[model samples]
Target: MVRQETDVTLRRCTECRGYAYGGGPACAVCRDLVDGLVEGAWAVFLRQWDTVAGGDQERALAEMVAAEPDRHDWRIVDAAFDRLVCPDCGGRLARGPVGCPACDLAHGFRYAAIETDRPGVPPGNEHAIRVNVSVVRRPQVTSESEVLVRRLLLPLLLAGFLPTTEAAQRMSALMKKSPPGRRAQLVEQAVEGLAEEFSRTRRAARAAASSPTSPDTPAATRHRSARGRPR
Candidate 1:
């Protein structure tokens, strides 16, 4: 079953700004920030998905999974054949589960008798739902420069380049590490260079797509032949 990843109220690591489920453990980004792993309480936990499994798209696919639901008709049909005896002669009960085939006698209907069991909780804690933890792996962030690159990811995403109020916190960290002028220069340099490369790549792709291929039709051959003839 495709279900939404456990994405409710996630907390952020103060040092790296990476997300985490609780306050106890240092998240992947901030290995030095905290000490102990936080024990979680019993709650409804959605299965965690890896990148290939489509991180958050599981929720959307869940709707597609249950698109067709099962339905059963409530009406019932019954017939008796074991007790089907000849109404006129009162002799043959040859019919098994249907009507008397030879006599054409109406034997009436037979229904399954249903008795409801008294509802009570089953004995055993084994039947109870088990509590499980959704382990969120840490982001494999290495350096501050990498973090800066990550910070610029949102603006660069649509440009087909390097793949946000939360962005303010990250920006604050970057600004603290470098002088204002240097920080601005660094960001401008990175973003502008990436933009130029992305534009060049996009233009090349468009050119390739739009370029006409060699025509294989007889008409193309004739045209080629015509062109080959000197004026």
Candidate 2:
């Protein structure tokens, strides 16, 4: 499940002037680093899972399941972001790009101003890279249970409901809970529920985006009536 924080307040980072979660530094750089490590680890873990058998395979899987939450812990990245600084200008990078010329050149001048609820690159290049790497590194699925989990989780994963590692972790948990006799039916019901939720979220987002702005009040109007008689 996606994690949630309560009663959070955003504050501008001292260096970048962009809002950070709980008023901490912008976490883009830290998020990038952590995501890279997690994706690389997943690639290795999944590949190993494909190669091993019996007790060895079970042990590896157990290790992965146990480590999954820590692998995606925000505290780790948040702490790292607090300490990290731009190498070129020695400025904090927690909200986004600092005024370092090199950093601006690398990330774009407007990087800090790009408002987003999620961390990392605004264009999703980081996510794309991770997905590509996972595809290239992980072996094709051979187990029926693995295949079922992937089918159940792929849509949500692609839709950004969760990260790849979390999806894999959830897949393992779900497979453990499902019995072969009713797995197909249970999976179908879960998929339908997820699809409905995704659709509702999409509709709400679209409605918000398309909602009309408030009408201009006369006091705020800048244009004046034409002078004299209409020409």
lDDT values, one for every candidate:
0.30, 0.40
Candidate 1 per-residue lDDT, tens place, 45-123, comes to 1233221222345434322222211110001000112222445546432222233344332212111211111122122
Instruction: Rate residue 198 of model 2 by lDDT.
Output: 59
Extract clashing residue pairs from model 2. 25-94, 25-95, 26-94, 26-95
Best prediction by lDDT: 2
For TM-score, the strongest prediction is: 2
What lDDT score goes with residue 35 in model 2?
Answer: 45
Give RMSD (Å) of candidate 1 vs. truth: 28.6
**Least lDDT summed over 10 consecutive residues: which range in candidate 2?**
17-26
The regions of model 1 sitting more than 4 angstroms off are 1-147, 163-181, 214-226, 229-231
Residue 154 of model 2 has an lDDT of 36
Alpha-carbon shift of residue 47 in model 2 (angstroms):
32
